[model samples]
Target: MATPTPPVVPHQGRRRASGALEGEVLAALQRAGAPLTPREVQATLSGELTYSTVVTILSRLHGKEVLTRTPRGRAYAYAPLTDEAGLAARRMHKVLDGRADREVVLTRFADGLNDEDAALLRRLLTGAVPGPW
Candidate 1:
């Protein structure tokens, strides 16, 4: 009897990159240019991610202020608040709002600034033209 050959199976599905799913999700939202239901976002990912996984990631991003969530019927819709600069501002506001002593927080923040950044902030506060980017 001839030996039977084993059937070969190719890789079944897409593999998630080590840390690129967040970028993937964010990029998908930016490409969408509008709030997306988690299901929609998952579809944009070619269904590589489950619906619950997409929703969980969205919720986590919203909590981190990286994405904004709006009420949408039985679930929330998600969209990026803005680019990196806007996210930094949102995080700053979140920290400032959560504090009981604004002065202490501001002092600590200012203390961490280098001379160049401090001067830039001064010029910003005084309505002076900031140094060229």
Candidate 2:
């Protein structure tokens, strides 16, 4: 019999990804419910991220239109374009829009759904139910 693999453990002092911080920043903005400067974002993270790193991540997300930024003095203030569900919906729409065959892609997606999932999707599409967290 093959030996079972050990569970992976995160290493200490490994370089954490900027994408991880981006989620944190997005959550912070959502929680704040207002635009925030990079310094404010860094502060919200409680010094876990450096000022410059946070600035770069914010700028990158803004470039992707995931976050909106407006000039605040010398730097910029950032806010999320939507809540988590809205963001996910936007991404799905973007992917569908990019593909030439919307019918085929949507057919495949709908065909893969279970009965319960299909019902939920119908309710969601008709705005008869709230979105998932």
Candidate 3:
């Protein structure tokens, strides 16, 4: 009797991120106010990614706490845990908090500021009185 043939299976491995795709996905999620399924996210992404690829990216971001997911039947609805600005602030705080010379670090940061930003900083500093409010 002829031996039965085994069905071919696709290899499963880690998917490496493309910078453009990652940025596009993140931007889409940021623009959306509610959780989005993989299909919905892919649809808003201008068809730049496959459904599976989108799922993989979402899963990776979810693992990193960059995004949160809620169960919806057999799939998940994903949303950004924090906005870009919030994420940046969190990262900046994490880095700055670990430094030995926070004041020097802040001074360097202030020194590096552009004219408009420096002017804004000056205004903010001048507007704040030491008292309470």
Candidate 4:
């Protein structure tokens, strides 16, 4: 007799990349341009994440100083301390913080930038305030 094949099962939900949820939450908060309660944030999200999960993400971000929270009735409302660009800059600074060879790291980063970005960086470094590209 031929062996029977096992049944194939599909994944119930799509897997997200690391930090994707956090990024999504941050984007929602930024778009609000105002503090949001956990319930509000959960509603703003895709409804995949739970209220407790949203609260947890907000608490974690507050701990990281990425977000600020204030008391609102029984729950805390959360707001981002900085915009997306500011968050990216913070991440870059964090990556360079403890390195003994920051110059090398910066050199590698500069070298990796495309011409347009390189020129933009040069203009910024030279104290020229150019309009947004």
Stretches of model 4 off by over 4 angstroms after superposition: 1-11, 130-133
**Lowest-scoring 10 consecutive residues by lDDT in candidate 2?**
10-19
- What lDDT would each prediction earn against the true structure? 0.86, 0.91, 0.85, 0.90
Question: By lDDT, is 1 or 2 better?
Answer: 2
- Clashing pairs for model 1 are none
Q: Which ten-residue region of model 4 has the weakest summed lDDT?
A: 124-133
Which window of 10 residues has the lowest lDDT sum in candidate 1?
11-20
Candidate 3 wrongly placed segments (more than 4 Å): 1-17, 98-100, 122-133
TM-score of each: 0.60, 0.79, 0.67, 0.83
Candidate 2: regions farther than 4 A off: 1-12, 124-133
Clash pairs detected, candidate 3: none
Give the per-residue Cα lDDT of candidate 2 at 25. Answer: 86
RMSD of 3: 8.2
lDDT of 3 at 122: 84
Which one wins by TM-score: 1 or 4?
4
Best by lDDT: 2
Global fold similarity of model 1 (TM-score):
0.60
Error in Å for residue 129 of model 3: 11
Error of 3 at 84 (Å): 3.0
Candidate 3 per-residue C-alpha lDDT over 1-133 given as tens digits, one digit per residue, 9 for 90 to 100: 9999999999977655576666678889889989999999999978867999999889887876788899998999999888888877777898899999999999999999999989877877898535232
